[model samples]
Target: MTRYKIGVVGCGFFGSSLARELAAHPRFELAMLCDRDFERAKDVAAEFSATPTDDHDAVAADPELALVVVATPNHAHAEPAIAALEHGKAVFVEKPLAVELVDAQNMIASADASGSPLMVGHIMRMMPGVRRLADLLASGELGEVAAIETSRSRWIDTDGADPQWWKLDKSRTGGELTHEIHELDLMCWLGGEVTAVSSIATADDGFRNTVVSFAGGAIGRHTISTRSHTSSWELTVDAAEGSVHADFHTGRVSRLRGGRVEESWPIFDVDAENQSLIDSASRTQKYNSGNGGSSLWMQAAIRHEIDEMAAVLDGKADSGSPLTYARERALVVAEQVRLGGGEPAALSGSAK
Candidate 1:
């Protein structure tokens, strides 16, 4: 098997985690780590046995780097991704694709022209529960999903903090576009393309909450804030036969049918024999399985995506097309923010 050299741009939590994981994967070598903060990038690079640099162009220019992961702040996603693709590297980008639709379209076009695969880290779509739900929906077990509701909220201590942060800025992080777009993507993936959306948003103390309606008559409500103490997400789908609820935070699933209810505990031991369609269709690849304390759910999703990308690279699998759909869903969320009538704020501070 050919080992791929991977470069990571951004030394934040997500980027650092991915770097460490890639370093451990036997199929990938962490070739470089980049960050605006030289010290932070150097620290992460040291941990992964990779060179640390403040210059993204150096990483993109590296002949050994076959893949690049852009984990930078929301506003910083486009340039590095485009640069890496232009330099002939496959790319994995954290969500929202880009802050603006135009940037997102450009990124997509670059990947198309470069003939290099581009994947968006809408990680929730890789979740076991989500995959199971998709399977159920496809099998018609739910019998026509009538409506879907999802919420993601977390409170971060930002007292006396800068109010013009990327996460709060409508122009950069795009508020819900960074955080809750996963839910939007999941809703659309399980439901259908959202033809239209109407939303209401509130911005105060650097937080926003919005509710939206999708095309297939499915409604979605979202709350994203840096002011909550706990991170919680739940998705409920109402169907003709009954309803299914999944507490994404806990990885628990509940079902109601004919007034009888049952709850399923987390399936920690993924059934090795029963491979999902996504799994079976994915390319085979070995990943550095790191320190092993990371969340199993997260590991599974990352592995699935890595495998899918490997397949695409190997010409044994189709390019992961869901990213385009995820992008469309993000557009709807962006429109929701636009129609919601929130106060305009300049982009400042890091998106993290």
Candidate 2:
């Protein structure tokens, strides 16, 4: 088995967790850990027996690093990812692609130019329950997917691993839409390409809702809330023949056809635990409000993603690569979000 050398930028919660997981995985060699905080990088690097540095450029320059995984903050994903690709390394970055459309496009362009395998980290699409849901839809069991509704909430605390300020600050993080873009990607993944989006966001109150119109006349409605102490996540899809309900955090997926329960399954191997939709760095990606954490299933999904990417890089066929799929759709969603649903013209891909 070929073990890919990996460099992870950002020593924050998600980054550290991914670095740890990569180090333990048999297919990966945790080569470098980079963050602005050299001390934090050192601590995490020590755990994995990997090199630690405060300089991101060092990782990009490392000839031994075959992969670069960018788990930086919502606004900071672009630079490391783009630079890594330019350096001839396969790159994976956690979602929202980038806070700005131009940056996202540049990242996509870089990947295209570099001829390196690029995949947007829309982790939920790989969830077991979501994978089953995708299976049902593809098999025509759910019939034609007409509409999808998804809702999620995570109560964030200022003292939490991720401070409240960074989560809510629209100026730095692109506000609530940063989170919603993931949902938007699911919409496109399940419902099809998002032809247009009619959305609204309240940064101060921390609420957002969007009515998306798919290319083929399908419809999708999504709600993302980072406020409130109660954390919950559920996505219900209605089709012509049946409907499917998915609990992202707990991994519960069910199907109802003709007013009867046709089938149901857990995203994880066991129904013994519940999962939430929100994977917060605050809880170290745990959904304690529901499941213990983001569930070991998510870790499996990441592993699968890494393995597939490694194969693709090694001349294997890769399908359904959302290299720019999620990012492009996310750019449209981000534009609408930053505009506060201002005008129909704001729906255009251009960002202010």
Candidate closest to the true structure, highest lDDT: 2
Which segments of model 1 are wrong by more than 4 Å?
Answer: 160-171, 203-217, 223-232, 262-308, 315-325, 339-352
CA-lDDT, candidates in order: 0.66, 0.70
Q: Which residue pairs collide in model 1, if any?
A: 24-288, 25-287, 25-288, 154-228, 155-227, 155-228, 156-226
Q: What is the lDDT, from 0 to 100, of the residue 71 in candidate 2?
A: 84
Residue-by-residue lDDT tens digits, candidate 1, 99-192: 6766777787788789887778887776666666666766887687778777656554445445654444555666544545776666656665
Per model, state how many residue pairs clash.
7, 7
Which tens-of-lDDT digit does each residue in 1-352 have in candidate 2?
6788999998787787677677877888998999988998999899888899988888988999888989888788888888899999888887767788778778877887888766677876766667778778879866778899877777654443334445445655676666556666776667765666777667465676888777667888888776746666778889999998887655568898876777888775533322332333225222222113234555676766665566666666445543434445656655765665432332222111
Question: How do the predictions measure up, each by TM-score?
Answer: 0.77, 0.83
Off by over 4 Å in 2: 159-165, 201-203, 228-232, 271-301, 314-317, 322-325, 340-352
- Extract clashing residue pairs from model 2: 249-275, 249-276, 250-274, 250-275, 250-276, 286-293, 287-293
